[model samples]
Target: MNNNTQTRTYAYVAAVLYAAIIGLSFLFVKMTVSVAHPIDVLAHRFALSLLVVSIPVIFGWIKIKLTLRDLWRIIPLGLLSPVLFFAFQAFGLVSSNSSEAGIIQAMAPVFTLVLASIFLKERTSIMQKLFLLLSVAGVVFIFLMKGSGMSAGNFKGIALLLLSTVCFAGYGVLARPLAQKYKPMELTWVTLMVGFVVFNAASLIRHVSNGTMMDYVKPLGDASYLGALAYLAILSTMFSTLLASYALTHLEASKMSVFSNLSTLISIAGGAWILHEPVHGYHFIGALLIIAGVLGTNMSGRKRGLVIPDKA
Candidate 1:
């Protein structure tokens, strides 16, 4: 086959793989968080992923050729994405039901688009902007209409989730060019390591302050907890990261954002099966509208200013 045909084929494969990774995400999240605290789950998840990738570092399969200049970019990507993003997202998952959290997270692409416009100077079509707006409205609708057990106590969780989306969105936009420069595998290797340092340091602080690193370790005795942790660290973090990087190589940043719409569906199914969370009809409707908005935004491509690469 010609080069263009080969590239398009890889893009299609990447899209499917990206969707699968997202679909499986909530299941792993639910499994991991069940026995451990959210922070612990995130901390160990990154730590394990770091360990898994170390083989590449050791064998020179991947090179960490980062300069002081690259540090500026790498630091923010690490901080916003795997560090703050996972921290908040995990906290949000713990505080709220998965169903609600899933619905809320469906707005990530919309938020990403907004951040892309501000940070990356990415252009969005007018219709793309409108659909993105509509997607946000759908999220607000979920918050107001369906209810999220939103007390002052859980308000922080909701806010955190929203903030995490912004961080992730910004990362997506900024990382695109980086993805072009470094192969996704190489990029993930570096970024995941950066994230690991930040998260493990934070984990260290928390553990020391509490005088209780033992508590986090104790959960490893539980079979399910360990299994869940393995799934998340290996499958979700390592494998998914690799798959997503592959997809980003193949697809346009704007086009890839559309795959994030699948997360709500996956989360809903996962919530129902794993968390036993109820899925209200309104939730389904909201999800549908959100997906529609994502597709519309992509197809219209009219506004061209607000594109953020969506995540797996």
Candidate 2:
């Protein structure tokens, strides 16, 4: 294969790994959140991710090529994700249940699609829209199958969750040009650093004000929490995002965002396998939709032919 083809293949692989890592991360999030506050969990997760990213830089292994100007450019991208995305999500989940959150979060791909088009001038083919819609539909179907629909009383949480999705979509769209300009590791480092400082500061401020600084360190005493942190910080926060940066460098933001829904499918299967959660036939059907959607979206038949609405 040519260099372009080879790199695209790697990007595809990286996207899949990103999806798997994030898919499994929900389990760890469940584990840690049960034992600790969400902000504290996020703080520790990024602290560790930042530490891991720092080690390579400290040892002169990974040279950071970022300038002050680049930092200024990318700071918002970092905040858009680990900062705003997680913050909004952490708070959004307070009143909203998982089912409600899942349904709303499914809008992320659509948000990314629109934002990429408007800001980045990224265009999609008719086939891409169909598959992207299919993938999103898969997620909504699963959440709706869980029995609770969007509650009017959860409007606050729902709005916050929608903002979180926008932040996440913003990250995806904003990273495209930046990814073309910078290496993935450089972007990843800045992202981790931003998340570390922002989340830790928020967590610490909350704990200190409550005279509960001790609560922050208490969760680490559990070995299970430690394990959860390892997976979350090292793999999910640092590596998966690195993979995302690399993928976004090679693939269009619209195509790359579609892969995020694969995590939903993986989450369901992982829950069944590890958490012993029951899976119904709908789960299988939804998984099929997600898998087929991802495949169809990425296989590259996207041409600017006659346009069709996503639903017909």
Candidate 3:
């Protein structure tokens, strides 16, 4: 295959994998936070992720050449994602249900599209914009049909989650240019390292102040907790971020953001099969809309003969 074709293939695969990882991540996050504080869980997740990614670099299996200027530029990108994005999300979930959070997250594509158009000069067709809205509407439809009651207290959570979406959308837009300059592994490693330092420091201060420094090790005793943490650290954080970074290298930020909607369908199916959550009529309807929107948004690429170069 030609270089552009190969790049597109990789981008599609990365998008799919990133969506799947994120879809199932909710389960692991629930299991983790049940036993540990959210910040502590996030600290451990990134700390371990840093070690996992570092092995290859330490052993010279993956070589990365980056200058001080490059590192400075990349730091803000990391701050946008694993730091600010996750902090908002973690705190947001404290007050909001998964359904509500998922609905708000569906708006990320819109934020991403606007940011891309302004910063990257990327443009989308009217049809693509409609399909993006359709995908978000599908999520809202499912939650509304489920009759999930909301309280005034949830407004705080909703606002925080929306902020998280904006952060992630910004990350997507910012990462695109950097992707052209850095390897995916290099970018992922740096982001994970930044998260590791920030979260661990925050977690340390919280524990020490609360006199829970010794209690911090208590969660490590549970095998189930360890298993959940492992998944979050490996598949959800490291692997998914790597895939997203790689995909952003080949896909427009708007396109990559839409793929996040697929996670709603995956989450629905996963809940039914794994969590034994009941499947409802609204679930099927919402899934169909999400699938249709995803296809409609992506179909434009084929008609327009969209191709990304292998190199900047």
Predicted candidate 3 versus true structure: per-residue lDDT over 1-312, tens digit per residue: 987777788898999899888877765676677788889888989988999999999999999888889899999999998999888877787776555566677778889989988998887778888888888889888978977556766878788889998998999999998998899998999899899999999999998899889767788899998998999899999999999999998888889999888887776677667656667998889878887888888776455434334465
Per TM-score, the best of the predicted structures is: 3
The residue-by-residue lDDT of candidate 1 on 1-312, one tens digit each, is 987657657765766566556555666676777688777788788889989987777898777777778766666666766777777777776666665555666667776666666766678777777886776566566657765566986888778777766666666776666666666766677678777887777778888999998977877788888787887777777776676666666555555665665666677778777768676777667777777776677567633334344332
Model 2 C-alpha lDDT per residue in residues 264-285, reported as the tens digit of each score: 7776677678767667888778
Pairs with backbone N, CA or C atoms under 3 Å apart (clashes), candidate 2: none
RMSD (Å) of each candidate, 1 decimal? 3.7, 4.5, 1.9
> How does each model score on TM-score?
0.84, 0.90, 0.94
Among the numbered candidates, top lDDT falls to 3
Count of clashes, each model: 11, 0, 0
**For each candidate, what is the lDDT?**
0.69, 0.81, 0.84
List candidate 3 segments past 4 Å from native.
301-312
- Find the 10 residues in a row with the least total lDDT in model 3: 301-310
Off by over 4 Å in 2: 93-104, 149-160, 300-312
